[model samples]
Target: MKIAVLVYGSPTASSAAATAYRYARAAIGLGHQITRVFFYGEGVHGASALAAPPQDEVNWGQRWQQLAQEHEIEMIVCIAAALRRGVLNQQEAQRHGKSAANLAAGFELSGLGQLADAALNSDRLITFGG
Candidate 1:
């Protein structure tokens, strides 16, 4: 099966994001294909390169990055939501005159059109978080 995941919760503030990650991993393990992982609202924090969790805590951003790398998943952050939360790519940072970009590697900032496309293309569109 082809799946697309939409995340809507913060990595630290809720378990929704972690649950999404586990679901993705399990789906892949079961020989399913994940077409896209769309991060919206507070879930955009999962793509923040500047995130610094405590030494004992798992860095969800890094975990997502690794997952994307290993599985070649299309990880996308909602441009509007991400921008509102101060998560910027290099181009966006430059355009907005921000000092730096905090978007983690393997994740791209895109529009809702991507989400629409994912929904249309995938066999299942699963939403996590809020």
Candidate 2:
């Protein structure tokens, strides 16, 4: 199966983001193809490079990055939502004249078109968030 995941929860708010991460791992473990992981709304926080959780706290960003690295999953963050929430990649930061970018590795900034493509091409489009 080809599965695409949409996340809308912040990593620290609730279990939605963590659940989505587990779902992606489980799907991959079951030999399913991950078409994409689109982070929207608060979920875009999971891709913020500036995030620094406590040592005991789970750094969801690193987890997602490792997952993508090992599984080759396409991780994307909605550009609008990310910018509104203060997450920016190098290119976007330069374009917006920001001092620095805070987008984490293993993720890319894009519009809803990527999500639309995932929905149109994947066998399943799973969403995790309110």
Candidate 3:
């Protein structure tokens, strides 16, 4: 099955992202194909490069990056939502005169069309949010 996981919360504080991560892992373990992981709303913070958690804490950003890498998952963040929340890519940051762009390594800044496409192509679209 092709699964699209939608996350719309902060990485550290929000259980939505964490729950989506777990679902993705479980799905992958069950031999399911992940269509994509889409981030929106405050969830754009999940892609922030400036996030640095202490060694005692779990780095949700890094965890998501690793999940994407291991499972070959396509990580996508909504461009509008990201920009609204100050989550910029290198190009967007430069275009907006920002000092740095985080948006995570495995994540791509994308538009709503991507989500629409994923929804159409995916066998299931599961949303994780408050």
Candidate 4:
């Protein structure tokens, strides 16, 4: 199966984002193809390179980045939601005259069109949290 995933909550605030990660990893382990993962709302925080978790806790952004890199999965963050939450890529930060960018590696900042396309192209679209 070709699957697309939507993550809608913050990993720091709740377990929903972690659950989504586990689901995607398990699905891929079972031989399912994950076409993309679309991060919206607080879920966009999962792609923040600036997040600093404690040594005892999992670094959600790094986990997601590694997964995307190893599996060749498309990881996308909603640009509007990200901007509203202050998660900016290098280009976006430059365009907005910010001194720094915090978007993590292995993730792309895009709009809702990418989510729409993922929904249309994948055999299944699963959403975690909201």
Per-prediction TM-score: 0.97, 0.96, 0.94, 0.97
Residue 96 lDDT in model 2? 90
Q: Candidate 3, residues 3-72: lDDT per residue as tens digits?
A: 9989987776668878888899899999999979999888889888888888898777788899899888
lDDT to native, each model: 0.94, 0.92, 0.88, 0.93
Ranking by lDDT: 1, 4, 2, 3
lDDT digits (tens) for residues 20-120 of candidate 2: 99999999999999879999999999999888988998888999999999888999999999999889988989999999999998899999999999999
Q: Which runs of model 1 end up more than 4 angstroms from their true locations?
A: none
- Model 4, 5-39: lDDT tens digits are 99998878878789999999999999999999999
Q: Which stretch of 10 consecutive residues in model 2 shows the poorest summed lDDT?
A: 8-17
Model 4: CA > 4 A from native: none
Report how far residue 9 has shifted in candidate 1, in Å.
Answer: 0.9
Which candidate, 2 or 3, has the higher TM-score? Answer: 2
Which portions of model 2 miss their true places by more than 4 Å?
Answer: none
| Candidate 3 lowest-lDDT run of ten | 8-17
lDDT for predicted candidate 2 compared with the true structure: 0.92
Question: lDDT per residue, candidate 1, 20-42, as tens digits?
Answer: 99999999999999989999999
Winner on lDDT (2 vs 3): 2
